[model samples]
Target: MAGKSKSLKWFGKAVTAKMEQAQILGVNQTMAASAAEAKQNHTWQNRTGTLEGSIDIAEYAKAEADGVHGTWGARDIAYARIHELGGVIKPKRAKALAIPDPKKAGGVILVQSVTIPARPYLRPAADTQYPKLASRIRKAFEKASKKK
Candidate 1:
């Protein structure tokens, strides 16, 4: 986990990790954002034999333009700086809110649910489900159902 926490080195010491992430990886902040985008969606040397589809090079180009972060932790402070520019900042100066309500509940995050559409990139499989995503859920459900 040393490798992982290394990436987290840049993460905020202020609020929740996620809020910290948003605080950092906003649009237009390339250096800060590249890590999050790399984690979210990225591509690399494609060696697949089946040469049959298009590439979302535009997305890759945009994302890669920011540059690949070597470690996830190191990108955190940069991400937070980028988050401030976008106006969707996760307030850092405030105290932590572990307890319920009264004092901690102040401002809000982005209310508008913006939908970032997903497009296929680096087609590795013949069927196109992301290989790294949640695959075992359906299998678990089926396995559990047989006992009931």
Candidate 2:
């Protein structure tokens, strides 16, 4: 029997692009949800609302050789790190740190440094949402595949 020869075309770039699109979509969605959760579920008292307002996607989703990358945090607020991870805060300019005296209505106490306890918001939120990341990516991939 005689058969006609057929040529196979490689579509590595297109396939990779589609996979990356799926990853980006998944990461963006998860990061947004994580940030929202962090803002809503925080245990810290909102004084000026700056911390909550600043909670956002510090880095947008992007496709990389390893995988999709993204980040969410209160990037602008300097104290965000201390609150999230727990740390000692020292005065940057002054000889001592001036912290609010919780006992008094309007008072502050001078100290060499203040130790802040960790009241994690972003990491916990991310942890809660990241469990579904595989599913999210799968769905995104399906969606991307359907697009023209």
Candidate 3:
């Protein structure tokens, strides 16, 4: 009976460890998928290649027995903000820039008001992946639990 109890305790610990590993794996997979989807969306939305290539995943915190934490985004891209949560991009009044006109000879054109419509890609990617992630995590947990 003492031997039986010891074996059971070991099995319990093993199961817990497996669950933690599964959770971390799931988080990593989700972050990768989210980053990929965001990158693809950036292309589909007709964005510059800079923003598309900037999408990436990073582990924000150490994984523990409970779970893992991480972040996926274009952290290095400066224009990520304008694409993610868009805002007006009006030209400075004092700095009214001039551009060479192709239609005329040595003529220049003054900069004018510009508006950028919101083309959110990250949040939408997260929203689309959220529903499927729960099931993926469950599957990962089950797979880990079944492993010896």
1 or 3: which has the higher lDDT?
A: 3
TM-score for all predictions? 0.14, 0.82, 0.71
Candidate 1 C-alpha lDDT tens digits along 90-140: 335554322344545774443223332333322222123323222333343
Ranked by TM-score, top first: 2, 3, 1
Better of 2 and 3 by TM-score: 2
Candidate lDDT scores, in order, read: 0.31, 0.88, 0.73
Residue-wise lDDT of candidate 2 within 1-148, one digit each (tens)? 3697888999789878888888888888899999899999999998999999999998899877788798878978888888999988888889998789999988998899888899999889989998978788899888887888
Query: Candidate 3 local accuracy as lDDT?
Result: 0.73
Global fold similarity of model 1 (TM-score): 0.14
Q: Once superposed on the true structure, which residue ranges of model 2 sit more than 4 Å away at CA?
A: 1-10, 102-106
lDDT of 2: 0.88
Candidate 1 lDDT at 3 equals 58
Candidate 1 root-mean-square deviation in Å:
24.5
* Model 2 clashes, total count: 0
Compute the lDDT of residue 146 as modeled in candidate 3.
Answer: 74
